[model samples]
Target: MSEKKEVKDQFIIAYLPDLDNTQTIINNAICFAKMLNKGLILLYISDKAYKCVSITDAEILLKELSSKITGIGFHSYCAIEGQTKDIINKIPHLLSGVLLVSATEDKTNAKVKEKLASNPDIMLKNLYTSRIAYFISSQNLNSNLPFNKVVMTIDNMRESKEKVLWGSYFGRFANSEVIVYYHNYKDEFYRHQLHYNIKFVMRMFDNFKIKYNLHLSSNSKTFVDYQAIDYAKENNADLIICQTTKNKSWFEELFTLKERKVINNSQQVPVLFVNPREDLFILCE
Candidate 1:
């Protein structure tokens, strides 16, 4: 008999800051963890320089939250008292096998600055790691869970394959339908590339026996990310899965990248952002 390979400990990290949307974030995190059949880590990170919640209080809060998981017949760990970057750096496996779920709001206005000072997106960028992240907004608190409908965006870039893989994974695990949106580029070279990507996407989905719908953009001039979000809203999609920018220009850094804009879209749909890396993690059976 062949020896069974041991699966490493894989988990979904839910960043639960001391905010008004704590329960909402927890609920969404639970949904993903359950869907993926992975362990859950309820994480609360406070800067040592500026302590928002005392160590004792943070522990107590985590204890209470962990109880919620247990009640639902799932196990979870509570982590506190470390910087997000340092904790992730310390755990090498976390960089590869973990999925991060956190709440984010539009930080463009003065009103939300104080609340979003410890935003997970900022911490994620600083980690310089390529783990997948799912960002949920307050507007999506009431959205249906188990994500019955998922929207995936594909483009000419090879990185778009990651989005297709993730979408297929979701379809297989959550029994959800994936809606693929691709741009109809007018440029011959780009259009050929787009066709190649779509072919790969179709093949992968068929192999997985996943149900999917395809939509082509009428106007290729519009930004692809925005178009994906618009399609999600029109179709009442429960989630949108797309790739993160591989490189950010100076202007993008200042004005925010396309993925950021999708996360903060006016429609307020939840987004799953997959970093374009060769060694991106895939969920195990």
Candidate 2:
């Protein structure tokens, strides 16, 4: 048998109704679907949710999950598998021929709650369902935006340009102008060197003819982590993109009440953090 190829359909909603805000999930999914001209897949991760349950129970629970969203002339699929996310994950191979509607989520909170601080969720419902259910919607569905601009934030770019190189390929593919922001303190010793680096970065972007923007930071006065957030603000960005590999350790500087104050105050524009292979290895070469 031939392997299935992923579908290229522009927008797809992959929903898990067993999540919180069931009503909101349904509402958002439908709204997004209509807004984006996309298809819907209502998946129930029967056996696949976690490794603890039996298959029989999984199927029963999955079907009873009631993850439904319907609209006139809309293409919707319903599946009660051992695990919903698992099937959704293998969709690239399973639904190979057609285009796929992928759902991406981050384990970290996008906006830190000022009062509650940090604590993990206990319920399966609270953890992933918020966006999973919306994946079924029409409003926040896959983007049709021309992707005319992209941004990058990093500590240093001395040796390896792998991260930027990868980001460039993506921006080039989308035909968007790219901005690379290097966030560091303006120490007296490296003041001159900072200017040179900015010039070099500009040249690299210039060669690509993609039209670039560069930002330099010299001191902790502005906070090292907050410059990108700040630059992203003054520019009024359409999408805030970040790249990382492996898990990032939270820094004391970042987690502190003072630090969170800085980041939390940043713009509310949606952020997109891309996880590329080069992030973990520190392509400082």
Candidate 3:
């Protein structure tokens, strides 16, 4: 008998009760997984308060999902688990590499009953605070693939390079146009420094042969998060990639709050949050 090949890292998709947006989540996950040459894992969890679904049912559903993604030149698996919070906490330790892609259906026009049937925001908060490389799909996506226009939000040139490095991979892989947006605030010295950093990142992009655009806002405008959201909408961007603000201390908690606001205001576009510590070399060919 041949020894089984151990799957190290995977792109995981959360399967909710309605499953209305599973295909969109799967499409993005597959594109990312194929780009990284990693496997895909479909994860389903049963809600105790809603339908009395068992692990068996979740497993069966996963099998059906597996059938749709088979022979895609990558290994795929299904995991039927309980409690999304627990799973999010343990994933980093359980797998060598993992990217969680979560999709939330839009309920703006749904009837009251249907709105009540959707998943709660508790797990969503957990995912954001977990510091994992994750993507949260906005509510009203048209279920498209190979995102043609992508936006990358950068705070400083120091961190902008990292953002560009990761964003370039998606741009090159999807053959998408990338726009780099930065907000100019604070003092001239800081603004000048950020511009230098942006230049540095642009140079790196040029060297890598990655095509992209740059946008910088003046300090007289609104909040940075709002500006970024507006720019994405104006461009009809399919995805917005951003780096989480560095967690320095209690004083820096505002960055986290701003990030949440940006996510909420994304207007149904997918947002990819890349952790600073994650290794990009493995993700790039």
Candidate 4:
């Protein structure tokens, strides 16, 4: 009798909306899975309940694809038949984990993209469950993986710690240097908050012996997210770590524009958006 292999509880979910357009998403997912030493899930969501791909076929395809990868510990496929909203709502309960990877470019129409950009609730409906999401941009379709440099943006908010944690985590796993960029706040209250956040990040990195650089932005007029993205582009950074919108009213969330710009930046640097929550998912070694 043969023994079944045990998979790790922490894994990366790569959502593939179309089988024909799987290369970019799969490549990026494999890169992350290998770098982080986590299992990989090739997930496909289909609205055709009766005509969706069968488990047998999906498994066969998954096996063929997995054969090409070298170091991934475990890999599997999941085909869900449901509306987009229903599937997004059920994902966290079914696959609670540290990270989710999805490509930003889809086959959707222009109107849909515009709507999603303006309304972050619909665009990132899944991350509200406190899942860290990495959205691969189209400009980085062929970029190399195992990021060499990671840029993290900090603001005058408690959520800044989450970005720091993720940036340090990536530095440990991928051996990438982290750039901590903070906005130059002039308000006394905001400046005090930023100081504490920067102090905490410095202490954490110093204790862990992670390689990092601090960059205090002089351009106070520009949005922090845009500044981080610009710095990453100019410095040849492979990834940017930032937080999603938090404590916003319905109107603010509906018109949330920073994340949309960062995700679709012309520089094409990949973004890892960490949602602010009391209980955020942490990756285990």
- List the candidates' TM-scores in order: 0.85, 0.45, 0.78, 0.84
- Among the numbered candidates, top lDDT falls to 4
The count of backbone overlaps in candidate 1 is: 0
Model 4, span 1-285: residue lDDT tens:
011324346777777654545677788888888888887877766545322465456556656665675667777767666665566545555664457776655323355433231132344553444444545455237755768898888888987787787888777888889999977877999999999999999998888888999999889888898988889989988878988777756665556646767776777777888878765666777
Clashes of each: 0, 34, 0, 0
Can you tell me which runs of candidate 1 are displaced by over 4 Å? 1-7, 48-51, 70-73, 86-97, 106-128
Which of the two candidates, 1 or 3, achieves a greater lDDT against the reference? 1
Higher-scoring candidate on TM-score, 1 or 3: 1
In model 3, the Cα lDDT at residue 133 comes to: 70
Q: Model 1, residue 58: what's the lDDT?
A: 71
**Candidate 4 structure, TM-score to reference:** 0.84
Over 137-246, each residue of candidate 3 has an lDDT whose tens digit, in order, gives 75455465566888887664465556676677766676778888878757788778777877877887787777788887774367555677777878788778876665
Q: Distance from true position, residue 135, model 3, in Å?
A: 1.5
lDDT of 1 by residue, 1-285 (tens): 011212465666676655445676777877887888876677666656432576677777777777766423344545456665666544335323367776754455466645342453563453335454554554337543767899898899988887786788788998899988877877899888889999998999999999998988887888887988888889888878878888777777556677656766777777888778666666666
Q: Rank the candidates by TM-score, best first.
A: 1, 4, 3, 2
lDDT agreement of model 1 with the native: 0.69
**Which residue ranges in model 3 land beyond 4 Å of their true spot?**
1-21, 47-52, 80-83, 107-120, 157-161, 248-256, 276-284
Residue 55 displacement in candidate 2 (angstroms): 12
lDDT, candidates in the order shown: 0.69, 0.40, 0.61, 0.70
Evaluation by TM-score, superior candidate among 3 and 4: 4
Q: What overall lDDT, based on C-alpha atoms, would model 2 receive against the true structure?
A: 0.40
Instruction: Write the candidate numbers in order of decreasing lDDT.
Output: 4, 1, 3, 2
Error of 1 at 121 (Å): 6.3
